[model samples]
Target: MTNKHSERRVVVIGGGIVGASIAWRIAARGQRVTLIDKGEPGSGASSHSFAWINAGAKEPIGYHNLNRRSLEMWPRFATALGEDVGLRWGGKVSWETDPVAAEQLQARVQQLQSWGYPSRQVSAQELAELEPALEIGPVVAAEYSENEGQVEPQMVVDACIRRMSELESLILTGAEVIDFDRDADGGIRAVQTDSGDFEADTVVLAAGTDTTTLAAMSNVYIPQAESPGVVIRTTPLPPLLHNVPVVYAPPLGDGRREIHLRQCADGRFMIGEGDQESLAEDDTQSHADDLLSRAAQYLPGLAEAKAIPVPVGWRPMPLDGYPTLGYTTETPNLYIALTHSGVTLAPVISQLAALEICEDVRADAVLTPYRPERFATLTEEQVAEMAHPRAGHR
Candidate 1:
């Protein structure tokens, strides 16, 4: 192996949006790269994603800034990939009916405004004006974050594949990683997959929920909580939402959670209960129909739409509810890029991951707080205390 970074061989495990973006960026930076996926690229969790791109729901000033930076980077990323990727930027509209919920939303909007986010409280009339198609009933309070939007994760993954093709990168789907060849120093020397083996100077584990298991193979500790969510789809409707690309409407009937819906570029509508990281396991057709029924209460246009159930998608959530990025102390040659808002963070995260891999340097200022070493010393009590609480970001 050579000391030149560009000449080094890098193997990226996982072909989801996160891994695909990172691998594409690495190949673009002049590295010999191989991307291995147990299944077809983007057919896993990426396909089941709601693909909302926003920073309004992220808390803590630093994390909010991180998502906001990535949110802003999405456009340039789409352009660089040389594809549409269905990236929309009309923003999101969410309102609450209960007084308590309305107060919480208002406070949240104020906090986001204080952080210079584009979130602002809107009157019920303003909400109707924002998206007139909505039959928003009894809005106690409403907020419109004009910068938040949505994207097509599968489209983005396909675009990455198209660009990586030009970069001459090796992408193997249906090839599972059986083992790894390690050097005497216990560092990754090569990645062994069912398809074959590829020599690796660096390996990135962005395998979504499987990252915890894969990272453990390299003596790296990365724990993830089981976060299964269902975002049902509806048959194509003629542009359901007139203005905004994303909608978070209050739950109707006996529903205990809010229902978020967004129309995809392909004309299908994705509707889901709760937030991005909400826990759910039901993927039955009845559950899908139920979600659509709840959504139709707010958006009457969906009344005629047929429900399409999506398989439960597990979110790649770190135990402490933050991203575990950067190289591990146990295996310096191995990089970890696991996070929940992968769709929102793909652009900036991939650029930073590529810079670190190609230059053999740490993104200290940006990623120091999210290094894999943070979980090394966590106690069992701490793990439970910080377990995936509520979904991350808006």
Candidate 2:
């Protein structure tokens, strides 16, 4: 490894939305950037997510503020980049059964109200008005956030890639990053790939589910739990539902899982559930029938809607439901960004990561608590030991 200061290049090891967003940000700052990926661009989990711009689940005023700020930042990228990105500003709904759970939702509404977001509790009548065809099974109450929205995940990533191309940032597909070599001063000098070595002054590991493997090459451990989410798209239907309805868990004695369903701009409806868990890598399975059966129970109109396609992907879930972002203590000039709601936060997170790289500081307060080193207190051996006790160690 050689001194990194000799070059002003940045190597982004993932070409998904996370890496593409960061590359655009770094390029905007007049820095040379190269994005490398093991497969075609935007074909990873970013393309597989529901692309829901969630707001209700993110409580605490600070987190809401981050979402709101990102919302403001999203349109600029879409408009300036001259791509549709399939971004729609439709609102979101969070309804639940169980009287006690309703009370908890009311508390969440109050919390959002304190944050100054227009989140209101709605009666069954209002819910029906919003979706006349919706079969609200015992869900008499709901919370509606007018500012929430959704986008076609792949479109967003494609738009980012187009923007990067326009900026002359090099993008290499089918490039597998095998190792990260640090200089004597502890700064990342180059990323060794199967094709060749690409030198860089900074490196960002935003490789969604694959981050843990990349971290191991640098001896940086990130404890990632894989959550399998299923997404199903229905055949085109006339515009029946105006707003996206996100129902919390337990679909009111119907023996089905709760999910959010919204009519896409193309007239198709998308349904999703995050209930499946996978212990092995490469465990991508489409639970389309389960999702469709449950979704049909909620939206009776879906009985007529035929199942078009189903896509399942893995979301990297960290302990405490938080993400690992920012620089790692194990290596310098090496950064990581992994989160469950990567689609919703990618715009802001990427901007913040690039800011830290270019300006030597991350001024975003929301990012202060999400540094990757939060897991530094625990070693991999310790975590393994805790998960599995020494069987024969007397």
Candidate topping lDDT: 1
- Give the least accurate 10-residue stretch of model 2, judged by summed lDDT: 275-284
Expressed as tens digits, the lDDT of each residue in 1-394 for candidate 1 is 2346667888999999999999999999888889999999998788998999998888788888999999999889999998789988899999998889999999998888889999999999999999999998888999999998899999999999888888889989999998888888889988988888889889999999999888888888898877788998889989878789999988664657898999999889999988777788899999999888888888898899999988888888888678888988888788999998899999989999999889877789988878999999999887776664553322
Quickly count the clashes in candidate 2.
0
Off by over 4 Å in 1: 1-4, 253-255, 388-394
Over 1-394, each residue of candidate 2 has an lDDT whose tens digit, in order, gives: 2232324688888877788888878876777889999998788887666777765566455666776777667777677658787788757766778677688889888887887777899887787676676777667468777777777777777777888787788889898988877788667789999989999878888888899898878878776754656567778988766565343334645564466677676778777653222222222334555566777776777777776555456766654356577887778788887876777787878878877887787664668767777677877775665433221111
The total number of steric clashes, by the backbone 3 Å criterion, in model 1 comes to 3
lDDT of each: 0.88, 0.72
* TM-scores, each model vs. reference: 0.96, 0.86
